[model samples]
Target: MVSITFLGTGGGRFATIYQTRSTGGMLIEDRGRIHLDPGPGALTNMARLNMDPGFTDAVLISHCHPDHYSDAEVLIEGMTRGGINTRGLLAGSVSTIDGIDGIRPAISDYHRQLPSRVLSMRAGDEADIAGMRTRFTPTRHTDASGVGAVFETSAGTVSYMGDTAPREEVTASHEGCRVLILNVTRPFGARLRCHLCSEDVPAIVERLRPELTVLTHMGVKMVEQGPEEQALRLERMTGSRIVAARDMMRLDIGDSLRVNAPTLL
Candidate 1:
């Protein structure tokens, strides 16, 4: 079975600063453990869930933004047993791994050496990550080289639409996935540049029609407006199964998807 854990769901600068919700990112447990994003509070939340970072098989960062990469190096440290061994994969966007457009690399050179393999991934690049067929998908975020990812897991295809505005190519890349995790930073009528808003998600959900569409990475406004209510509106608009991910909420995917009760911090 494949299981997904939402470590933290808050996003955007203000939200991250005030921390209305945690920004720990998501964790996927299938054949192996893969941590995506690893933003602030990732380690702390993992401890809350009784997860050992040393067992993580890979770390996937989508962009250079702090909300997406802050805890990555430390996680790499844990994955490598405090750098005593090179044991895991570190895959990230060009900007996140190699730096681009003045944005510095997220994983330091010292930390980069800790992972058994380091991939500076771009959109369309594919690799074997902890037994999953992983593909780097494109994003139209402020970080020009930012990328999302799609994982072909044993249970089904899981796609993460990283920080991006609603775009045709973005939707096309995530098509035919059983699960689509969107970084919905704004609520309805509160659109922002390079970020997905509530209004922009309906068409994407309608077109792809995944078994589940998870709304996460909410900003202050979206959180204040009530993510659950926003999700309900989107579900009504698209006739799709949509959920607003809470911190520590777990989803088990086997023959079907099941949302488990969240474990609070």
Candidate 2:
């Protein structure tokens, strides 16, 4: 079975600052544990849940945005046992790993050396991560080099659509996945450049028609308007199972996908 635990659900500048929802990212447990896009509350939330960062086999950052990579260095320290051991894989976009344009790298050089292997990923790149076949997918975001990912797990394919605007390539890259995770940072009628809005979901869902579509990484407006209500409206329009993920919610994928409600700490 493949299990995914959502550590945080909030995104955007204000939402992260105010913490309308947590910004810890998600944890995937399959062949090995992977913490994806660990942001501000990632380490704290992991401690709250008694999840040892030392067990994390890999840490993946989709982009260089602080909301996506803030806690990465600290987590790398944990993964390497306070830098006492060189273990685990560290993967991120070119922008996140090497700094594209004028943007600075998210991880420091010291932290970079801690991971046994550091992969600078680009769209269409394929890698074996934590015993799963992973593909880097393209994204139309402010960070030109930013990428999403598709993981071929034992149960099925799980795709993470990183902070991206609705684009044909984005949909095409994630086709046929059993579970689709979207970083929806805007509410209905509040679309913005480089981010997914509630209004943009129907068409994407119609095209891919995955078994489950998860809405997460909500902005302040989305949080105020309510993610659940937006998800419900999108589900009606798309005729698919669309869930608005809450911080700490878990999804177990096996013969069937089971959503375990969040238990706030």
For residues 144-180, write the lDDT of model 2, one tens digit per residue: 9999999999999999999999999898999999999
Candidate 1 local lDDT, residue 170: 90
- On the 0 to 100 scale, the lDDT of residue 126 in model 2 is 97
lDDT by residue for model 1 (1-265), tens? 9999999999999989998999999999999999999999999999998999999999999999999999999999999999998799999999899998888898888998889999999999999998899998889989989898999999999999999988999999998999999999999988899999999998899889899999999999999999999999999888899999999999999998999879876
lDDT, each prediction:
0.93, 0.94
Worst 10 residues of 1 by lDDT: 256-265
Q: Against the true structure, what is each candidate's TM-score?
A: 0.99, 0.99
Best by lDDT: 2
Give stretches of model 1 more than 4 Å off.
none
